[model samples]
Target: MPHDIISGDRHPEALPLAEKVREEERARIARDLHDELGAHLTGIKMALGLLRESLARAQGPEQPLEQARYAEQLIDEAGDAMHGIIDDLCPPIVEFGLAEALQWQSRMFTRQTGIVCRQRCGDGLDELGEFEVITLFRIVREALSNVAKYAHAENALITVERQGDVLTLRIEDDGRGFDLASAARNGSGLGNMRRRAQALQGTLQLDTVQGKGTTITVVAPVAR
Candidate 1:
């Protein structure tokens, strides 16, 4: 067993604390990436734009003008990539809440992977704490990522429902499912999802059949 797993089992209370620390670190890194690298990228794009204008005004070599325009285009792409990375590190749950974030994530997944994805969210989820909201968002994001990378599914669905004080999150896909035993031995994604669920005092359930599909469900109390 991994050392972290052994430690978590021995001191279950430490799991949530560890998760909190990891999230804080991710947020800090995302902020730095945005404030530093993002600013630099923007400045470079502005400089390239100015160069292009100057070259055009002077009627100088067309080659330099073309190069400046190309550089600006590359900078735009880099800016977009940076924003994606920042979103992954620390999503906009604080700004848009979990429901909107999940919807955006599903759309992005479909756009990026060409896999149709949809979200269905129920009521009574507006009162969750920041920790619970972010944790749940990460769990679903990881699940969808797995689907895109390994599930080879054509369609996916994310459902969030609340029944009384209990909240349920489910991700279903219509793709080839693998043997749970083999995946347990070969991948850490499942374990990561389990750990996040544990951090929430929640349960993670995975149901799958070879050549059929897979569904990951998480149930946790909403009263906390």
Candidate 2:
């Protein structure tokens, strides 16, 4: 019984220190949101405002439409970039838990990129610890980043499942895939995803073929 209890206590050795570190990390993220990300987003918004004003003051049909379209693109890019930064700073998942945060993320991604995203999760995901949650979040974040930047995907799938003592996450996309060796040599986002996975004592694998698609799988031990 004592051993069972000990086994169940994931952070027994440094619970207080872990709590303190989490708080400090959160504070750091908040500061980044306020100082760095906020400032850049504000600057972009101001620039867009000026552009809109100039476009409004212009007298033309063809050029005005073009300018307006460009302005709209700028606004959308700025908005998406700002939201992405915030999401990275304080993962929406942290406060809202796993499911809702993931749903929101999927919606935002689809809206921003016009890429369809579907997510599924096993009921057991709700039982994961905070660390596991963050780990899974990072895994998805990296996958979505690749989707946004390189996948050129029209549709993507994300699924989370629990099997015995292990939890698994899969992110698949139908897009133009690349050579893993070449990408690895160039140190792409896949490497970052792998590192994030390793940090959680997990593993991430990328499955892709040129002109086909890509699937990233992450698996880790489930904390009791």
Candidate 3:
């Protein structure tokens, strides 16, 4: 959502202010939905179930039974939708910790895309702050999304490690690489990835060779 992304600006150090703002807003909404809306939805579902049981016991009239059935169906649909929104807003990542989250994501990706994704994350990553944890999660998520959309590769790998004060993440795919210039011209995924890496006061390196593969490496400080 940054101007650089839309205008195809390729400055490495530029931050995606718009994208960051969007992410922050997303986090806030995730919290509110899960805490407020989610609770309400759950209560509604429970109430509907109780009402259905009451109707069954009382031998309610046919008209009321039909309406209750309709209402229960609606509540069930709404509950499912609410769950999806909450998951998107605040994934199951934080609950399981970063390393496990990455592993789960990788396995899900492999299952979904049939593109073998291997993950090797070192220990102690669960100790990072929330900001660092989510940032790394988003980085890896976006990287795999790109691979799914553009990589056309059969296998991909993700590596995470801690070295001194720095935390490093690498995503590599043996796909049909693209022209750097052309990719920069698209200015969406690549720009967003770079902006996120730079936002953490980290560095991102992209290596791609046509007909070979692409590797994205990001290194950021592990905030205490």
Best by lDDT: 1
Per-prediction CA RMSD (Å): 4.0, 9.6, 4.7
Count of clashing pairs, candidate 3? 0
Model 1 lDDT, residue 44, Cα: 90
| Poorest stretch of ten by lDDT in candidate 3 | 1-10
In model 2, the Cα lDDT at residue 167 comes to 80
Better of 1 and 3 by TM-score: 1
Global CA lDDT computed for model 1: 0.85
Per-model TM-score on C-alpha atoms? 0.82, 0.65, 0.76
Best by TM-score: 1
Ranked by lDDT, top first: 1, 3, 2
Candidate 1 per-residue lDDT over residues 88-165, each given as its tens digit: 888875567778878988988999999999999998888888788899998898899889999989999999999998
**RMSD score of candidate 2 (Å):** 9.6
Alpha-carbon runs more than 4 Å astray in model 1? 1-11, 110-116
- Candidate 3 displacement at residue 45 in angstroms: 3.8
